[model samples]
Target: TKRYYHERVLDHYNNPRNIGSFDKKAIDVGTATVGAPACGDVMKIQIKVKDNIVVDVCFKTFGCGSAIASSSLATEWVKGKTLDECLEIKNTDIAKHLSLPPVKMHCSMLAEQAIKRAIYDYKVKHEKLNNSETTTIETIASL
Candidate 1:
């Protein structure tokens, strides 16, 4: 079964940007890992937030081309934006950008979730450091 991938998706997948991890233990970093059980596709998105701005981001995705491209795009979009601005990024935007089919929409959804989760993790961490911050994020199993 042949599936179509947009040129944008191929471009991102073939030359993904910001593909790496951050020190989740750092006070300014937020990390989140999300997965699609049915597809066994997992994506980990990490962000370094300073003054409420996403100063840096990276990702590791274990999935298909679409999933890889989606997370790759997600990282690119979030960086240099405020957390609130990052929230404006909807899965639909990623789907449209990737020209993903309905079946592949889940990939974009995962990316969105990862972004939200990572931001949340950052907030939690910051608050903990201030005696009201801290909420270490969810799974990455081995990260």
Candidate 2:
């Protein structure tokens, strides 16, 4: 049997979009690196959120063609979307869009995880900042 890939998947793999990293020190940036132990696939996703919207996104994948394609497509989709919108992106949607084989479904799952992880990291950081601000206000009031 001949292996086949969807045109969109081939296009993404051949010309990946947003394949790089942002400055880790930037407060508006969040990054997540995740690996699929079953397939030895690793992916890193970075998102730049402004006002709760994903203004930019980038990714790097160290895996198969499916993994790279999935991550590339994910980055493109998440950009310019609110975090709530991004969270609605499902692995099944990606797999269906790519016409990925059942064996390659995990690639889409990994891509989804990368996006969620990045968003979670961003939320955690912001929560810490908010907590610190509240603490400082309390201390000033006590003084």
On TM-score, the leading prediction is 1
Instruction: Count clashing residue pairs per candidate.
Output: 5, 0
Kindly list the per-residue Cα lDDT of model 2 for residues 56-136, writing each as its tens digit: 999999998899999999998999999879978988999999999999999998898888778867876787446754564
Local accuracy of candidate 1 as per-residue lDDT tens digits, 25-127: 9998999988998899999999998888999999999999999999999999998999889968999999998899999998999998899888877877766
C-alpha TM-scores of all predictions: 0.87, 0.86
Q: Clashing residue pairs in candidate 2, if any? A: none
Q: How does candidate 1 fare on TM-score?
A: 0.87
Q: Which stretches of candidate 1 lie over 4 Å from their true place?
A: 1-3, 128-143
Query: Where is model 2 more than 4 Å wrong at Cα?
Result: 1-3, 128-143
> After best superposition, candidate 2 residue 65: deviation in angstroms?
0.8
